[model samples]
Target: MTDHLILRPSGEFAGPVDEHTLVLGIETSCDETAAALVLGGYDVASSVVSTQVDIHAQYGGVVPEIASRAHLDMLNPIIARAIVEAGVPDSRIDAIACTIGPGLIGALLVGVSAAKSLALAWDVPFIGVHHHEAHLYAAFLEDPTLEFPLVVLLVSGGHTMLIEMQDHGRYKLLGRTIDDAAGEAFDKVARFLGLGYPGGPAIDREAVHGNPEAIHFPRAMMHEGLDVSFSGLKTSVMNHVRKHPDVSSEDVAASFQAAVVDVLVTKARRAAQQVGAKGLVLAGGVAANSLLREQFLDACVVDGIHGFLPSREMCTDNAAMIAAAGWHRLRSDGPTSLDCGAFPNLKIPGLT
Candidate 1:
């Protein structure tokens, strides 16, 4: 395969060309190999994702090496498909964006390398997007009118935190997990119960048939600051399973999920109040949890705050959100240097 793939712009479709710039986004932060063409940043033209769920299912969790290899194999085809579906030629892409950090280094490099190669070939701007920041911007993709000075709850497999967003690229971290993230805890607890890989969904489905209050799982840091601790909770679930061998897995899943939701919702509510936020935004993989979304919305209503939740598709790893964030960054700061490399612990620059 050639290092650069080229396509001619199709002139047949007479869409509104001057209204928005078309950007191609790539994301391989973890197990999902994704590419998307976004219009004016917010409007998704086409999004293609190749998931490694089945590949990692047997292992009960993602294997970093396998994920990176899968991205290398699938990234090209996915990008081609996104371009085709968008009906936009490669030459029409105004800029290219890729997630640069706070993820598996191997997986991130595959995307970053591809993005840099494409930018060089197309002679277009290359924007490096932070993984977590893209999650926050996912809400903006659906709600373009969403105002700033909002409280963002970012809960994924690797991260769990509350951020006060004052403006685009300006963030103040309010709280974070001291140990395992909410999703990580779910996966660990799911394994303890033999629930299977991708614990979040498995637990969610089973919890529907079980009693959330049947077992009392601890909700750490509930009365303290914005920080959370799920390691203790995970251990509690393990001890419960070990002591009560006959305890129903469904009840364990329900109770564990409830505990996590309780902490997340409480912290988000408190952060919003403290910051006087105009709205509360939920993003990242854990935000896809049914219980969490329901509880968050209810909490928002009780606290008299507007709640913004991206669709399930947007909640998970994807390139569209990266494109949306990159669009704004490109406009404000231009493109990053071609020498920019992947950052495993990349944080928003202005955030503390």
Candidate 2:
């Protein structure tokens, strides 16, 4: 356990708790159990994330049961750590927010249950957040100057979508993956090439030395407006590896990334043009890939569209992003009741 204890006043605290709302945000959407305390406005007081990567690493991916069990074990400690680090007593927390959907049902329940419990115990408001929407709002935490009417490319292990954001609450679904998500393709291809788990970063690292043009790979749906597909591409990679069993892994990684990047950038460029968006923001765990970042920036430069990405550490699962997302929810509606249940297949509120 990480120590973050802080002393506080005994009777009356210095300032009004309502004047400065501190929100406790919890996220257990997948394999990470995260908690963060964010002050009213934009300050992140404390963030704690307990990962189940090692436990899931051997399985090549997250096991829903294992993830839920791990979250059950870490949820309380993670929340306690956030509160301690924030130097705020439980009474100071104005609201509780949690990732409520678009993830494993069991995993989502852990965070939702914890948030509901805290809200009930403290008589505070409870707010539910969508995981992918939270990813888009992550930009707010890193870049306060970021405004709306932008295009968001949300790429993750389970999702690949293009969203046009008109404002804080309004969204237009431009396109989405027709098959496997980009991150899922990366993981599957990496496994095929004998690379280990959590494949995006590993593939990106290997692609640096290998030539992306080494093998000719198909860029799917390049002419099909903004919709994308990676299943055909993943199958192509599998077939290539089977035909050439002795091919170099580095070359395979490069070729795979090249194909993915080509499709992603192509679609993003089209989305920017179609929607006339001024900015292009990349969100989700796969956005951490250095190659994707580089390729998207290059595409944005050619298209004269600004590209934005969160810090690499924020790309994966974390509560800081969730807290930032919760800020929007709290600002709009205040809080929620304890009966808010976790939703497994939730999409972006408006996009669905």
Candidate 3:
């Protein structure tokens, strides 16, 4: 494993002097075009995210081609606005950070290209941030008390993973979704139930009026290891909908949400206990789901573990988290090679 820490020049005065790093982060991996500036470790100096939901809502989901095009249009201005809001010039930024992978190919390229260009122009180091790593770091921004060797549950549109955060910039992947990320399942199920686009929040909103136990949905891998599998459960919900032609959609939505929460929280709790983690972190867009938040918090309370969650705004795809992560990476090591490019399938080095 490559070292991430960078040694600073010795000061005339002994002891440790505070080293502050500023990072400008760009995230265009999916539907939202985001940019942010972070200072030191946790302070979000500025954050700007441009949503393309209005354009994608008609289709009930994001279209990759359209999303890529939309990113191209909004990215430049979004980045500029973030810098303006941060009240800092490009020259002051210590490093550039961008999400490079595990997202739409074209969408990932827009941010990567912009980041590379900016790094070149500014003569700063470029750092590539893993999409999921940013999610875990989101917790640090919200709760500085969070410690290492903790379990991090990342629930999002394109990913559902359980990671062990051994230390800063170090991770161990414990488990992940076998098929269909949690939020992806939410979107597909919502569309199947005639709910609008951006399924997680939409479905979460509609589930309030229905009975969670109205339908008995299967919880996949509930009795097994921490690994999760939601695809079969999603199919089961579809089957339920088919069998009950007269059933209310509200019940279907509620039942479906219940099943998902059951498996998600249950597995998360299991992972936390198995690892004897000191802290539990929840992140990603699906982490914004009210039911999941409530259930996970409740479980943590019962299990006697510290639970950390990002502010609702930080739960989704955002550059603030990336900037926060990048600042840490920068302090550890200067930055990535200026020639760094996009990695659509970028992995957290040695994580798995």
Best by lDDT: 1
Off by over 4 Å in 2: 1-19
lDDT by residue (tens digit), candidate 2, 147-202: 66799999999999999988886799999999899999989988877788888877
lDDT of 1 at 278: 95
**Model 1 clashing residue pairs (backbone):** none
lDDT of 3 by residue, 1-352 (tens): 2222111211221222124678889999889999998887688899999999899999888899999999999998999999999998778887788987768889998998889789889877777777877888899988888877899999998889999999987788889998899999999999998888889888998899999899999998899887889889889989988998888888889999999999999999999998889999999999899999999999999999999877899998899998887777656655566445566666775375
The TM-scores, one per candidate, come to 0.94, 0.92, 0.93
Model 2 scores worst on lDDT over the 10 consecutive residues at 1-10
Clashes of each: 0, 0, 3
Clashes counted in candidate 2 amount to: 0
How many backbone overlaps does candidate 1 show? Answer: 0
Q: Candidate 3, after superposition: displacement of residue 346 in Å? A: 1.6
lDDT by residue (126-240, candidate 1, tens digit) is 8888888889889999998888789999999989999999998789999999999889998998888888989899899989999999999888879999999999999999999
Candidate 1 minimal-lDDT segment of 10 residues = 1-10
lDDT (0 to 1) per candidate? 0.88, 0.82, 0.84
- Candidate number with the higher lDDT (2 or 3): 3
lDDT, candidate 2, residue 206? 79
CA displacement after TM-score superposition, residue 216 of candidate 3 (Å): 0.5
Which residues of candidate 1, in runs, are more than 4 Å off? 1-19
